[model samples]
Target chain A: MRAIWTVAIASLCAAGLATPASAQAPAQRLPSAIIMYPNILADGVFETRIEMVNLSGRTQDVKCHFLSPPTCNGTDFFIRLTPNQPISWLASRGTLGTGNFFVNAPPFNGEGSLKCFVVPDEHGIDHQNAIQGRSITFGPDGYTESIGAIGIQRLTPGEFSTTLELDGDTYAQCPDNYHFTFVASEPGDPATESELILSTCDEDLENLISKTTVVQFQIINEFEQLLSAATSVRCYDRKVLSEINSVFTRDTLGTPTGQAIVRGVQGAVIAVIVDKFVTPAGAPAVAANEPALSRGRPARIRIP
Target chain B: MSGSRLRGVAVAVALALACGTMPARAVEVDQVDWAAVLRALGIALDSWRLSPFPRMTPTPTIPVPTATPTRTHTPTRTNTPTHTATRTQTFTPTRMPTEPASGQLSFDPSTGIAPAQRLASALLIFPYVVHSGSKDTRLTLINMSNRNIGVNCFFVKDAGPVYGCLEVGFRINLTPLQPFSWFAGQGTNNPLTFTAAPPFDGVGELKCAVDPDLPDLEAHNVLQGRATVFDEDEGNTVAYGAVGFQRLSPGHFPGVVPLDGFTYDQCPERLHFQVLTRQTGSNSSIVLTPCQQDLLTQVPTSTTVQMQIVNEFEQVFSSATSFTCHSVKSFSSFSTLSRSTLGTDTAHLVLRGVHSPLIGLVIDQFQGGPDNSTHTAANDPYLEGGKPSQIIFP
Candidate 1:
């Protein structure tokens, strides 16, 4: 009876392969072979809940790297997902009961970026576009904001390598600039606060060397008035918009809503924006969104 | 003995084909016989694919562009914007470049459409979950291109005496780089006048198209938008980007647009939602809007949608729902989506519109969090399969 069931399942699998996997178009907002969450927190009163789902009909092996800033050191792990398997874990707790892989949590009071790529199979078949992911960050004020994982699909089917190129060759190139808008932070009334988290796409994980890039911020108010600010980011940085420059506030911009265009001078970076505000009913609310991406220069990631 | 041999052959063929499509490293072939069969079958399959069979399209070998990384900037220098300060010099961001550099496709040529969320186009669709009254939805529309653009937006309710197809149309003019936002209930009156109609407590969709009357512009794709829906009492908020359909051919503006790939990109056939199964303190709901809608005729679109829930163990349970114009289907009632049935806390959902291509949003809520508060998050459903659909304007 078991053998009979196995034959039946095999027949179904063979029949389903009539339609090629390449026929499926990539959804920029969908799953990719490689996905990244720019900001994950595991500090006091904060935890990041990560959810990843395999969208393909086959099993996938994933290699994940958690990189914290300052030194930009990485903690590596592996996950094995069955066909269409969905898994969720807290960044602070790691995947203890998920049955995929056992990994220790990153250091306490540390926040950084998490990147995972589908490992090519033994026959060297690349399933670079098979997973979709999202991360929800729980904050100290009892607020939670969810951001979809930024997925980068392989431009071509090639053998896996330790040196991943983000240059429209091996994978889709990282964006040159990011455009995002937010309501200005004001002191009185329903005060609003926004945080921008940025992670560099160019890194040498093998040597644990931190790559610093100067980022330029262009601010445009609702009235079309423009001002500029500059900052340096090494590996990863998360900061309140006002801290970079007070011009981000409504008192300085002279408008309630403003748009910021950020560009990295030496390398490319991916980012997520979080905005917290109070509703008319005086209840606290938080909203998060990924910035619009513009393709530009190439960046490289060297894994150990 | 022959029957047993035939069964062996069948199993070998099945495993080979399935393994061919899967990432090889993930598969563990413990038996020597299966491994040998897979290797032999893989070789045969590669040869067959390399043949000139029209149906069996092999993965084309795209030569990796050897373009030396040309962008070299000094570590201390700051990069400047390339454009001057002019109205037409507004900054527009492209998630994925539709036009590949030097004809080398950044994505696979076989995949018809690139995965994108913030699409640049003359038309934008906010598929669902816009509310009023106790709950409010704030909409932000930005003219991404340089130069002035005229905007016409239609807000349609999803439930009512008329089957909730009623619409309120409004117009606004946005300068280059200008963004306009407003609450659905409060409404805006800067040359546009309309408000959410009574019952005052319902959800709907907002469709915004570029108006070519004042600017007399061509079909230059340059509109982008985002929407945030929040509950006043619960203080829960969810935000998402709008779906954009870019016009393909160059011509004067027309009232009716056919999304036949020639005029504009077709809508997706299936939407994949990453959802948490109905567990102790979690719930998921999806809002679907049909791709084919006639706002000019005020005729509602009816579509029968097929939904499949794929559990963690790769078990699939299926269901179907039919609705007119728009529908919000909750997983609370689907026993197959329950944690007990799925045997996991999360599952993958695939929705296909039987009659029309569709677009939608997935809203998730988790209760009993740290402070005993309910947390809500909304995301755009990943899309698959492209099918032609149409939109009629007034």
Candidate 2:
């Protein structure tokens, strides 16, 4: 009976239903993309799986970097994909035990995020335009879902900058102004966190080439009132994990549903994911980010 | 006794028994037959002696006790938004949780849908429980297109009309990659519209209709976006995601199509959802919430929607008829929905809408300590074919 259903799903997957694990956005050419497993548990209870596919016309070089919060937990690995080849990984536990291990994002107690992009290197094939991917996380009491990886199109000339600089200034000049918006705090209660995903959107960097950028911030209350702060960002693909209240209340901004205006001294490509985490009962935790293009799409402007 | 003597004695006893009367003393000598019995038992005694004894009973299934419906419990998150700021984002934050843990997610903000000739529309369906002890649905909707688009939203309450269709709906416009979200309980949308709907003290669904405008002179790519839905209560928490439907329509550009070429009239031929219904002093159950998207258009009163529940043994248990638009039903072990026994097991939730194409969600959960609760929601299977439609804006 189990075999029957297993085979049924397998065949159906081949025919239709599971056709696109991530309802891929239509594109003429494959582009660089970022895949996140977001929440993972390997502490014996919950588990997370990442499915990656080379949806390009040629073989590709897949570069994956695992980022954990609290203490800048970072690791990197490479994947070689023939055209249309697919691969799956056990979050940070690596490629299912063969040990090419690289993720330590979870089981440390809470949640973490990961970023992946396809780029050519001396060791692997040249860039595969874009990689279609999905992340599934499940455990005993929570829900499991396979979500499509968010895609970051290949950066065009000046589309994204690593050093905050003037819009038309040379790469060496200081960024007139660059900041990412995030809603980290909520209202009423003060336990929920407004987590942030600070990804390095610069996919075409030199091999092992890493750079650092200074960041400043204009924290705002729910009233859109300005507050204070900032941090140093390493383009090595890392996460900025912080509580909304601590970062946005009387100590920071003023209330739960406040905003953070993250300003970079230099220009760089970055994507911010503001996830709201809460466990009113204190045991099981869940996050819900108000559906808003508040973070990913940064406004274009010139800062003095 | 000697081996020869024992055999001879056994033969004598057998002959006496066959002759007519076998003495009890004859059976007392039966112990001597142990050696012969071993030889007669034949087949691989060596292997049998080495092998672990197999148990006689089948796997013991965990029995799930029916949950005494509770009306009040601490929810993971609430919908009632406080006045943190005179003004907040479209999707406002209602409460702060117990703790703030670090987190991250690499989203494909633009990867779900492709350009299609059809005036394609995507359907975003989710379930919510807003009663005293109820759960709420928190979700995010994104517009992946570079051009402006509009979305029509509908709130389908879990109960029938006597409870008032409970559907409070409205529309919103998106500029390029705009995202909008809110808690269904307190209210969503600008004027706090959903707050006006009846108190949906039960489970129900939300449907958002993507672009309903058909293609103009120039062929254009349709809108696309990513969705994340979280089902949480103070003790229980579950989260999953569904990308907007991608239409693999056949034509010159046979790759991807939305809204089946943007055709206004469309419905899935069949839908299948795998669910886990755990029950007990330990809280487990498979929740199947099916809503008929075309309810408002029903004729002569209402339409009958039948859902057949099939267990692992191929046994089918069906539900009572559903006339109204939405229904949130639960089937677990030892419950009225079971065939014989109700323990920890898996089954398929099957049903179809008579006149309207249906949308369904399946959640499996168990209530426990420390961690409070655990649950998982599986993916929806569009077995027959994709059956979501574009919305007609009011």
Best by lDDT: 1
Per-model CA lDDT versus the true structure = 0.68, 0.38
Q: Residue-wise lDDT of candidate 1 within A169-285, one digit each (tens)? A: 346667676667777777756467788888888878888887888989988776667889988788789988888889889899886677777888988777677877676677667
**What lDDT score is found at residue B32 in candidate 2?**
52
lDDT of 2 by residue, B1-394 (tens): 7999999997675554433333344455744554444443433445556556542122222111112111111111111111111111101111010010110111111111122111122444454333334465444444444455555566556454455555566666655433344454444434421212222335555555554344431112233322333444443334333323322321232112224323322344234443444445222333333433344542212445555554433344556354444554555433534423422133444455555545544444433223544444333332222344333323
**Candidate with best DockQ:** 1
Best by TM-score: 1
Candidate 2: what lDDT? 0.38
